[model samples]
Target: MISSPDDLLRLAPDAKSLEAGRRLFYSRRWRLVGGDGQWLWGEWVYGSGQRATESAVHLTAGHFVCNCRARERPCAHGLALVLMLKNDQERISVGQPPSWVRSVQYQADRQAKPKPLKDAEAADERQGERLALMGAGVEELELRLLDFARRGIADTLAQGPEPFLAAATHLADAKLPGPAGLLRRLARLGRDGTEADIARTLGDLYLFVRAWKNRRTLPPDRHAELLQFAGVNIRKEELLARPGLEDHWLVLGTAEGQEDRLRFRRTWLRGEKSRRFALVLDYAFGEMPFERSWPLAASFQGKAYYYPGSYPQRALLPSTTPGGRPYDGLVGYPSFVELRANYQKALAVNPWLYAYPVYLSAVTPTLASGQAGLADANGEVLPLHPEYDNFFSLLAISGGGTLAVFAEFDGYRLLPLSVVTEFGLVKG
Candidate 1:
């Protein structure tokens, strides 16, 4: 028989581990109906009104597995079952993970890869389209930006050390219409540009793009700090040392666009517990921002490392979609039928699914399926799972809250959308 509750508590004193287990337990309580030693199993009711059986697995390694949608190392249901087992020492027959678990796991592993999501490509395409929309003369410049973007993307996909320098050099001193025009011109530089030139241009470009996209979402100081990355390298360690912003910062949304002669990425960050304070990490071709995001949020009571060093720890409310695009700003929300029709029309025109899944902030609120939605600092509605919901593109939503889509860049490195946006370059 199991000892007291304190015994179980003593077994896992690591606060982060305990918190993770607790969070997992509460997140999906449905699967854990009850257990018996011979064959620990329970029925999991789904939104579709279907009941699926999931076996409780207690492994020799002390690992737990529950057959559910979450692919975490120890899924929420599994943790719940473990907690139950720990307290109720009755020897129960916990069966192997069910067939569905194997099936779901197989599907997840099949789709897992280091490829950029569809939105990355969609962002590239959208940048092209946006440039074309800016003016007719910008076409030639757009072609150039596209070239640079291709190379930079390639470098990112391979996880190369620093590919931005090569891509950035191609854009220096190029002139075009607005910010997007500049990026298009830069892209035309090809491999002939210098590394130093690329770094400087990228540095400045990151700040501009990030500031524009997230102007409404961040507080004044954070906005200023992100904007500063355009001309300076804000060390990650420096940001970590600063005070009053440590918690799980959720990845809200990603946007890609281009400024003149530069490509950009903007990754939005919102604190799940702290609220109020938000961050935008802007990345450009040559310069890289320090990785201060983790320390900036997780430090509390002078003790750093508040978050666990495990998967599926940090997350926040999903993002809502932005209101109407440039000319469509005045249009009312599209009806479901209309939206579906438009989505279908989009597919017919561009039949191939996005190289990577395109993620959008929800234009409307929805809880169905795997989509996530939350309001941006500016109060804009961002959609979380448009690619999965509308395009039927296979994807894997990670426990770390990163949305992974498969697309290859010619040479560009994977950059956070916030970094790209900060530079006022094209956002993808």
Candidate 2:
């Protein structure tokens, strides 16, 4: 069966493309729209009025092909074709796919085929090439960091953001997106951030560079972690082949963020018995098939195959079965002191873990000294993220009592995400 227009719209590269697809879906720009049992297709009279764009989507395999000059995949022509098949199917004639439609399937099958030994060797070679590329990028970055140390941050940042941005672009070109992101963050930090914040960012970048330089001496898991931080991808198949940690996992919370053109959501889960934390990160690019979600406060019995690392936080949950609510409501640090200690412990394990999830049971929302914060039973204050403006709603939920809170701890402050009260879960 074909997916709905909304589902198809989820993959659109941008709202502009989605709107364009919706318009194309109903417009009279298409002719001979048809489908067999397995494929939905159409011929769109696109910009070059003489050359008709052949748009086709596989009914079962979710493959889409369009013979058009559009740079993006599953372009508007294909999206509109699917919408037509779903919302206006009678307009589509029934027939087997022609040669052009079958070509997409052939490419998909070739790409999906397993060439274990050869692919592994090829991947290793690619990793080697990228690492070499990273070496050149890292050398220039080391010099930048050296300048910060010698010239002083005040003196260096006074020179402005150009140097930092150029270094970031070079790292990106080197295929080291992870470090590239850190460099960009530094450039954005500029002179606006506090002395502590700037120092911490520089420290993290320095340690990461050190980790990269000594990656070969690192243990297998640590080495893998380093590569990932440097923007190297470790395929799911590689992680799934590893033994998994079976547990009754509780959904701690979810957070969303956008990077460049892609939007991503991170679901934080913790094992009921194993006590291990797992992060499930999913990304969506308009018109791409990255539809993954995990319900909040739901319990799932599953085996999580973690990305190999010293901390082993992010993981791949290949499958899950409903396991009911966790033994009780959200359980977390008894006090702010304990939360800080635990975060420090985590930092000891992975110094680069800038943002870590911290849960607090029975914390009351408080506003004092012009700061929004959370207070544990003893009245110890943990400041809520400055950007968070949901305190009024949280206060309404609290009604002058304690509420369970889940927040991301970034060394100095807590960015409250969601609250669990007697009524239910409320995301901030």
Candidate 3:
């Protein structure tokens, strides 16, 4: 009663997933694959030690529920189940839906509840209580991460995003909001992100937990970075007391977005004399304006104090004076080769680094089938940010000729922010 194999293949996220589903249909590790008049259900087997997972699809609503680590919708298991119903109904055991199928059917309701914590102990602890709690929280997180790996990828799919999200309360108690945010991100991915997305986050959490356990061995600055990311806040006076860098800072670009009722803004700047990059982050409640204002492509004489870190970048400008553009030309990496090398060096010092601002020279804009990117002289292409919607405007500025671009690089993709061509500055 469901769609044909051709129609079912369309449900797969990509060709690889469709191929995988077809292979599962033929190789056949499926157990108890069955269908009731309104629903299709089956059991999928992983290798020897891994447990078999149950998957189901509602015929009328066309809903797919699966317990595999695969990130795609109607994953191999779901698609193969449909194929089984369509091709080999005799092999399927038709009957009333079992208890397991009925219980996990409404996946949204199957959240893993958070365990309780002893608030009295937390209240009594003193001196290094914060660190102690964080250490304990990190340990608990390590257990969950291990469980995720030991149980295999299908574990979360079988349970739902709740198991991953369950760590939030414990992390909040430990004052490790950053790690908690990462867990939330992982849970979201467990629900919707691809295998690659989930894997990257798992690796990040593992490294972060190990880093916390061995925090003492890290450099003093690196340790501060860890604390900074772990939701640690320092007094403004203390930060200003540290030596600040004074330079002619040029605003490269700024990006702003909103989530829920909170709006956020990030402005990036580069110093002409020091060639140093600085990021200023600000958050405002609904309809509120940001604290700092640095318009794009503007230059000013200012002193910026940076937060303590191995690769110090986020900075606060306490004061500024209107200034003209520098007499010297804008400096940038000659090619992607040097740019990547320097970026890797920065990442080596700060693995938790998010966006590394960069200036590149001698590149051309490229657009193919709705995708946009920049190409260097040697034909090396760095993709523009996936969310970028200013391709045509950027192309107009370049005029099919080479130009200099300022952007943010996040290890994998580049978010082109502004371009300086013969016509002047064009913010993307």
Roughly what TM-score does model 1 have, to 2 decimal places?
A: 0.23
Instruction: Check candidate 2 and list the clashing pairs.
Output: 11-286, 11-287, 12-286, 12-287, 13-286
In model 3, the clashing pairs are none
Residue-level lDDT tens digits of model 1 in 1-428:
33433443444525555676666455443553444332234454556747553635423324244444442334444454566556544433444645544564465555554446975798678666643443332333345435545667445335432333333333222222234332433344324444544544444445345444555686654444333322223334444444433444434345445554344643444444544223243434323222222221122221122111111111222223322222111121222234345445544433221222222222223233554442222344334432223222211222222232211111121121221122322222
Which wins on TM-score, candidate 1 or candidate 3?
3
Tell me how candidate 2 scores on lDDT.
0.79
Q: Best candidate, TM-score-wise?
A: 2
Query: Residue-wise lDDT of candidate 2 within 350-394, one digit each (tens)?
Result: 766767988888888889988888889899887776567788898
Q: Model 2 segments beyond 4 Å from truth?
A: 1-38, 42-57, 60-90, 93-107, 286-290, 324-329
TM-score of 3: 0.66
Candidate 2 to truth, TM = 0.78
How well does candidate 1 score on lDDT at residue 187? 48
